[model samples]
Target: MTTFLQLHLLTAYPPSNPNRDDQGRPKQATVGGAPRLRLSSQSIKRALRVSEPFRQGLAGHMGQRTKLMAKVLLDRLLAGGMDAAQARTKAEEIAKVFGKIEPQDKKRPEAVQGTTLAFISPDERAFALDLADKALAGEALPTDKELARTVLRTADGAVDIAMFGRMLADNPDFNRDAAVQISHAITTHRAQAEDDYFTAVDDLQRREDTGGAHLGEHGFGSGVYYLYACVNCDLLVENLGGDKELAARGLRSLVRAIATATPSGKQNSHAHHPRAGYVRAEIGGAAPRDLTGAFFTPVRGDDLFDASARALERTAADIDRAYGPAADAVETMDVPKGQGTLAAIEDFAASALERQNA
Candidate 1:
């Protein structure tokens, strides 16, 4: 049985803020009149990393690396005897077939030396050409070109499915739905309060305008979290078993999987917000201070191992607690014997908390 599971997280921001605001004060908020640690976008991103299938999967395994698109094309074109300018032009055409390229620089020219490419859109053609110049100079190819191809082929379909495959291979039975739920929980755990207080442009000419607030109610707080998840139901059914009851039990696992965090950086680097959220730690009666600095935290080698352990323990427990009753309730549903078994399993899952309580 692929009983082992885990979710790893790297804070999107620094742990705490070192700088203070004007009047030597740090930003803070009171939750229930008690200090709720101010959280940064990094903190939420890290917490959600383990549960996000796309991120978690790509983190450990090889992804569809387009970094070599330009290099590969360049080499092929050169082999066919094309000049640097002609090579880039032809290579660019081939690249379009695969994916869009970005913009290039004019003033600061890039050295079009070796096979090099940067993944970009049509609008970013300029950047793509610029990066290609550097790529050519180094004559370096992406380390895992083949691996990237394999993943990208699938990305062409349900991108999350390929992503989930990688995540499942690493986590076994991990599913996309579960990962999403977890992300939602982490994201909604605490909402930021808008700073609606009026700013005193001048004491006598105070205006009724919000000050130092984020966009959309709270700046840097509200926005779509472009989440990517992949789920392998077959893998899940295998671990859980063909028995309807057993399959039903899998729902809990699914929920937990969705709740796990996905890693950041690399493929996931651009997944989160430029500025996510943060958590502040306060000492004594002092105000809360922001902890995170960056948008996402990079996973360390040690974190890879620790993340698995943590994901398994939490996901397993979450499944058991979240699915028991749901599984039992499945029995009440109208269905054939085999189907009923599945229903029972689902019902039992509904009472997941009861099982954990037991």
Candidate 2:
């Protein structure tokens, strides 16, 4: 039986633009017939992957997502004393194993980059570099197929790649399906972005200077946001090549990152780093379901966080009443009430791996 782990979080931000739209204003979504500040799943997942907790916990088991694979390989080959022309050609050949190469710019003819970003695991990166060294040493270059087969991996010990998955347009067989699904966080209550206008004074201004050196305006919003995520535990383990221990550790790190990590939009201007006020974790063989419906009507109260928490609980209870229990086990960490600790939540989520193994 396939097991699923679901997490719901309520976090409040104060006067910050953690995510922005094309206009450089805070992203917004219409929910329950009202506008609400929004945070994209892409931004949230990036934040989680780069979070300190994930870095410390996963360490070497992380991957790099970039279009500069060719550039990196070219630099390494050149540094190894290979001819520049030969290095660029070798780098481009190896890079094509991952994705299509971008056309060389006339101004920066030596620079090489992929047309699309490729998520390269550390092991895969090392393999590519090793291949480059072999070629530099006069070894016959392998075909693109051979290079990809030797360099590409489903996960390659990269927990982030295993969790978030990656797609290789040229080599679809090497692509891994995402084991986790994240929802765009939306404010539980109707909220609109407000503009903040300010001026920066010239540090070396003469006494005669009356006006400021620079002026700008940016948008920010404050509200309690409800976020949802579901993990296919079975797929996660499979993606990790059945390394249950690593999967368990990954779950713990993921929980911590989800709870503590905030999107890095305009943090320098508005340091709105707030932890999740409430968290609910569930694991079971039953099909996964998100509790986004809880805020379909949009929560309202003097204490928005408290009200949002209660609404989430109420929604879960209502769902249970309607469809029976959706999870065999559930754990929560309510920061405001001090009812549970993050450590306890982490243990609870990781315990699913044990159950699966048994």
lDDT leader: 2
Return the TM-score for each candidate structure: 0.29, 0.97
Global CA lDDT computed for model 1? 0.31
- Return the number of clashes found in candidate 2: 0
Model 1, range 3-88, lDDT digits (tens) per residue?
Answer: 11112122232222211223222233443333222433333333333344334332332223244555555665566555767677
Please give the range of 10 consecutive residues that has the lowest summed lDDT in model 2.
349-358
Candidate 1, residue 151: how far the Cα is off, in Å: 12
Residue 132 lDDT (model 1): 46
| Runs of candidate 1 exceeding 4 Å displacement | 1-61, 65-68, 75-82, 108-161, 164-182, 185-358
